[model samples]
Target: MSRPVSTYRVQLTPDFGFAEVAKIAPYLRDLGVSHVYLSPVLQAVPGSLHGYDVVDHSRIRQEFGGAQGFREMAGVLAAHDLAVVVDIVPNHMNTANAQFLSVLEEGAASPYADWFDIEWREGKVIVHRFADDLPQSEHYTVVDWREGPGYRRFFDVSSLIGLRVEDPAVFFATHEVIFWLLDEGLVEGLRIDHPDGLADPRRYLDMLRDRSGGVWTVVEKILIGDERLPDDWACDGTTGYDVLNRVNGLFVDPEGRQPLVALFTAMTGQDADYHAVMARSKRDVIDLFFRSEVERLARVAGASVQDLVDLLVEMPVYRAYVTPGEPVDPVARRIVESAAPNPEIARAVLYGSPEAVVRFQQTCGPVMAKGVEDTALYRWYPLACLNEVGGEPDRFGLSVEDFHDFCAGMRPFTMTTLSTHDTKRSEDVRARLQVLSELPGEWAEAVRGWSRQVSFDPHLDYLAWQTLMAAWPISAERFTDYLLKAAREAKTATSWIAQDHAYEEGLRAFAAKAVELPIGDFTALVDRHAVANSLGQKLVQLMMPGVPDVYQGNERTDFSLVDPDNRRPVSFPCAPNSAWDEAKLQVTTQALRLRRRLGPDAPYEPMAAEGEAAEHAIAFGRGRAVAVATRLPVRLAARGGWGATSLTLPHGSWRDLLTGGLYSGRTPLAHLLSRHPVALLERHDL
Candidate 1:
C-alpha cells in the first residue's frame, strides 16, 4: 500500500476546483507531498475562498464541483498514489446569508435549535455583545433567543455561530457529513481547524479519530515556545510550526538581543514589563476594533456594568485548555502568592495577581505553558519582538533542561507552525523580518540614512511595514485586503504601506540595497545583520527538528507583508518554480534527497568536529552523511580542517554530488566544502 498523503493546503471555489487540482497534483507529487490538503467542501457561504464558513454540513458546495467533482478528484489522486486530507471546521459555521438569517428570524422555536449551543431565556436571543469599540447599539441588533433556523450562539462571534459538539445530538448531526465521506473513503485524513476555540478539544479529536477508523488527524493548534499538545489524543503530529520556531530561533544572534530590545524601547516608549506591554497593546486593539461590542455589553448588563468590565479584563485568557466544562479548579490566593518571586510586581503589571494565577493553576495544573505567566504571554503575545524577550540562542531565561522537557513532551503532537490564520505575518515573511533583528546599531543607522536620502519618514515606514508584515505570519486568505489597508494607513515612505506604486518600488529598492554588501562587511557594520536572515532560515529548517512545514509559495522567497499582500495567489511568473529557480531547486532537492537517503527511520547521532574556521562554520553528521556549512564565509575553519581539506570515508570512496568531486578515506573535508555554501556526503554500507 502507498504511504499516506501529507503536506498540503486547500484551494476552493474556482471555475477550476478539482480539475485545477489535477493540474497541480504532479508538481505537488514531485515535491514528495502525499496528500492534496483541501479546504472544506461542504456547502458554504457562496464564493467563500476558504470553506471555513460552512452553510450546510450535509451537502458538498454546488459551486465547488459538488460531490461528483470531489469524487473525481479523489480518483485522480488515488491513481497517483496520493490521498486526500480535507479540513473540517467543527467549532462553528457561517451565518453570512439568507439561510442563516432565516434561522435568526425564526428564533428558538425552530426544530434545529438543539443543533446549536443555545443559551436562551424567554424569547430574547442572547448574542454576545463582542466589544466596546463597535457601534453595535446604533449599527447592529441583538435578540434573547440563542438558537434560530440556521444560526446559533458561539462565544463572541454571532455572525459565525458555534455548535455544541459536547452535545451528543449536535455531534451526531455534524458527523453525518463526516460519516458519508469516511464510509465512501473520499478522504483519508482530517485537519481540524480552530481547535483552540472548541469546548472539549481532546474529546472531539478522539471521537473524530475513532469514528474515522483511525484516519490520519492533524489539528490547527497554536503552541507557543514550550507548550505541548495533549498526548491522549490519537493523531499524527501537528501541521508543523512547533519545529519552525526552534529552527528559526537557533540562528538568531544572541548578541543582538539587548540591542533589539533597546531599539524597540526607543521606538515605542510604552515598553515596560513585557506582559504589561502586551496588555496595553491588546487593550488598544480591542478599544479600536471592538468598541461597539463592548459598549453594547455594558448596556445589556445595566447598572452592574462594572461586573462586565471585570469579566473581560480580569478573567484569564480563554484557550483550548480553559474552555467551559473542562476540569478547572480555582487556584488559592496563597498558592498564587507563593508561586511569584515578586508578588507586588506581578500584581502591578501582569494579567492576574497571585490569587488569579493560582486559580488557573488549580484548574489546569501541568497545562501547556501556564506555569510561567510571562511564558504564556510571550507565546500568545503575537508580536515577534515581545515573544523574543529572553530566548537567546546560547542562553535562556528558562532553564535549558526545562526547555528540553517541554520540547520532548511537545514533539509528539504539538502544532509546529511558522504562520497561522491569526498571525500578523507568514513564516517566510517573518524570516525576512529577522534581517532587521540581526542588525546591531549599524543597520539601524543605514536605515536612518536611507530614510534621509529617500525623503521619507523612516521610522514611520518601518512601523507601517511591521504592522503590515505582522499579518503575513497568519494562515488567513484575505491578506491582500489587509495589505491595501496597510498601504493606505502608512505614515511615511518607510512605513509598511506607501502612497502608490512608486512608494512600493522605492521601499523594495531600499531592501535590495540593504542586502548588497558582503556578509562580513555587513555584519561588521551592524552586528551580523547580513547573515542573520539567511542564517535564521537555515537554522530553523535544519536544527529544531519537528515535522517541518513550508508555507504556500514560501520555499524560494517571501516578500509579503500582512494579509492582502501575503494572500496573493502563487502566479507562475512571480512565484518560484522549483523547475526553474536553479538555486532554490538545488537546495530543496538536496535537502529532501538527503532526508530520503538517510532513511526517515534511521537513528541520528549528533557529532561535533573542529573546523579550520570553527567560529564561522558548523559541521554535524547524520549517520554516515556528514554535513557542513559556513555561516560567515570570511571566517575559515580554525584547526586547519584536518589540513587535508578533504573528508575520509569509512572504507569506500565518497562522492560530492554538487561539485562532482570524489574522495577517499584520506581527503580533507574543508577543501571539498570550500567552494560550496553547503556540502553533504553519504556512504552506503552495501
Candidate 2:
C-alpha cells in the first residue's frame, strides 16, 4: 500500500505561528491530516510573508513567535501524531541578513567573502547582469551592487541575492541552520528549494539527506519530459511539476491544435512555428538582460570586454560539464532543431548569428543533457529550463502519444499540481485556454465579440489569452491593480526592456469580461469545467502510482494567479454560513476515508473500458472497487453528458458511499454523485 498524502500546507505567521498550533492541531487530527507541510519558518526578512527569502539562518523568524513557538508547534504536531515537513532554501540566503549584508559592506575583505557567488576584481562588488527589462537611467544602472543588502538581481525587484551554493562555505553556512532545526527535533522532513539553480545539485541534496538522519526529503525539482531524477539521491520524490505537465496535457485535445495554430498565425502574421515563436520570445528575454550580466562578469574577472563575451559564450552548462569530460549526445542537437525551426527567427531574436547559436546551444545542451546522461540530478531537473520554455505544451509541438508515454513513466512519483509559487498562471486561468478545444465557430465568435468591445491591441489580446489559458477563475475586481503589482515586481522590464503595454491592458480587459458574466453563470462555469478538471486531476494523480499533492490553498477552490497571489494566506470562512468550507471538509474526508478502506491489500492498476462516453472519463479499478471519473469539457454538457452508465458490479449489491444511494441501473455516475465527487461502491459481502 502506498503512503497516502493527508497533507496540509500552512503559511507560518505571527497570527497563527507557534501560538495557534494548539488550536489547529486538533483540527488537523480531526481532518485526518497525516502531515503538516509548512512554509519556511527560519529567520527571514522582517515582514517576509513567505519564508523562502531567508536573512538569518541561525534562528527561527522572531515575527512568527520564534524558537519557543516552533517548539510548541512541534509538540502540538507530535501530540496530533502528524509529521512536520519544513521548506528549506539550500540555494541562497536573503541579502538582508547580517551575514550576507556584512559581506557587501566589507567587500572582498569581508569575513564572509566566500559566502556568496560574488566576483570582486576592480575594488568593488560585481553584478552579473543589468535590468534590460527595466528603464535605464543613471540611477537605475544595469547592476546595482550598492542596493538593499548584498547585491541586487532580478526575480522581481525583491532584494534577493543569489548565492554561489557551489561554494563549500556557502553550502555549510546554509546547512548549519537546517541542521539546527533538524537536531532540535523541530522538523521531520525538508523540501529543498530551486535545485535547478545549484551548480552541483546532487552534492547538496546528498549532503542534506545524509545529515537529515533518515528524514523524508523531497526536492522542489522541475523535470520537463522523459527526464528522470537521479535515483541515487536520498529523496521520496519531487514536488511534482513533471506530473503536473503530463496530467494537464492529457486534458488538452490533440485535435484542437490546428485551429489554435491558425488563430495564432492570423494574429501575429509570423511564419515561425509555435515552438520557434516561443523560443524567440525566451531568447529575447535572456538577450534583453544579457548586457548587464556580461558587463558584471567582465568587471569581476578583470578581463577585456571581448574576453568576457568569450567566456560566457564558451562556459559549459555547469563548471563540471566542460569539454574536458564527456561526449555530447546526438539527441541534444535534435532537441535544438525541434525548438528553433527558423534560423532567421533565432538570429533576429536570440543569437545574433550562427556562432552565437552554437554558443547558446553549447550552454543549453549540456544543461539539459546532464539529466539524460544520468547525472546526480534530482527528478524534474530539466524543468528549470523546460518550464521557462513552455514545458511540453501542445503549442510547443508535443503529441498525445508522447505525452501519455511520459505520464506512464511518472506513475510511481506523479505529483499533479495546477498553480504553485513558481507558475506564471494558475490552473483556473489555464482552464480558460482549454476553451480553444471548443467548436471553432463558437470560439471565434466569442473572441470577435470581445475584441470589438475591448478595443485593445491584438498582440496584447493574445498575451491575455495566454495568461487566461494558464490560469482562470480570476477575480475581476482585483485585476488591474494586480497587474500593476506584477509589473512593478519585475522591475523596469515593463517600461524599458520590452516596451510592452499590451500585456497590462489585455489582462485588465480579460478580467473585466469575466466579471460581465453573472455570479450564477460564473459559478456554473467554474463547477462544470474547473470542478471536472479538478476531479480528473485527482483521478490521474491519485490513481496513478504516486503521492498526490495539494498546494496550500487548492483543495476547496483555487482562484489564484501566480506566486504572491496564489500564495495568499488561506482564511477559513467564519461560522454559520461557511458552506464552502464545509463542502471542502466533506470531500477531503471522503477521499481520505476511501483511501483508508482500500487498505494495504488493495490491488491497483489502470482500468480499461469501451464506449464513446467512457472516453470522456478515465477509469481505475482496484480489485472489487472501480473508480470512473468524468473528464467534462470547458462548457457544460447538454443534460450532463449521458448520466451514469452501468458498470457490472461484481456479485453482491453495491452502495454509493458518497450519496448513501443504491446502484441498480445504467444511471449516470454524475447523476449518482449529485454534487458529491466520486462514486464509491463496495460489495455487499466483503
CA lDDT, every model vs. true structure: 0.48, 0.52
lDDT of 1 by residue, 1-686 (tens): 22242245545655547767766766666665566667678888777666777878778878878889888888888787667777888878865534334445576656566556444545534553333442332212454323222223233345577677767677777768777888898877777876654556777877777777777677765455444566666677666654555545433445556765565455444243554543343343233233333333333323133332323333232232432332332332333334334444224212333323322322221122122222223222212432321222222122223323444454432234454433445554454445444444655564345345432333334443343333223332333344334334322222221256776555455444333323234323322232333433443243223433444555454445444454556642224543323444444445545554554333333333343444443444455565554443222322334353443444666665556576666555467665555555566444
TM-score of each: 0.71, 0.75
Residue 656 lDDT (model 1): 57
Compose the digit string of candidate 2's lDDT tens values, residues 526-554.
Answer: 44554555554544454444555556555
Clashes (candidate 1) = 70
TM-score leader: 2
lDDT of 2 at 495: 33
Off by over 4 Å in 1: 1-6, 13-16, 97-102, 126-157, 268-273, 285-423, 453-460, 465-546, 572-580, 593-600, 611-676
- Per-prediction CA RMSD (Å): 8.3, 7.9
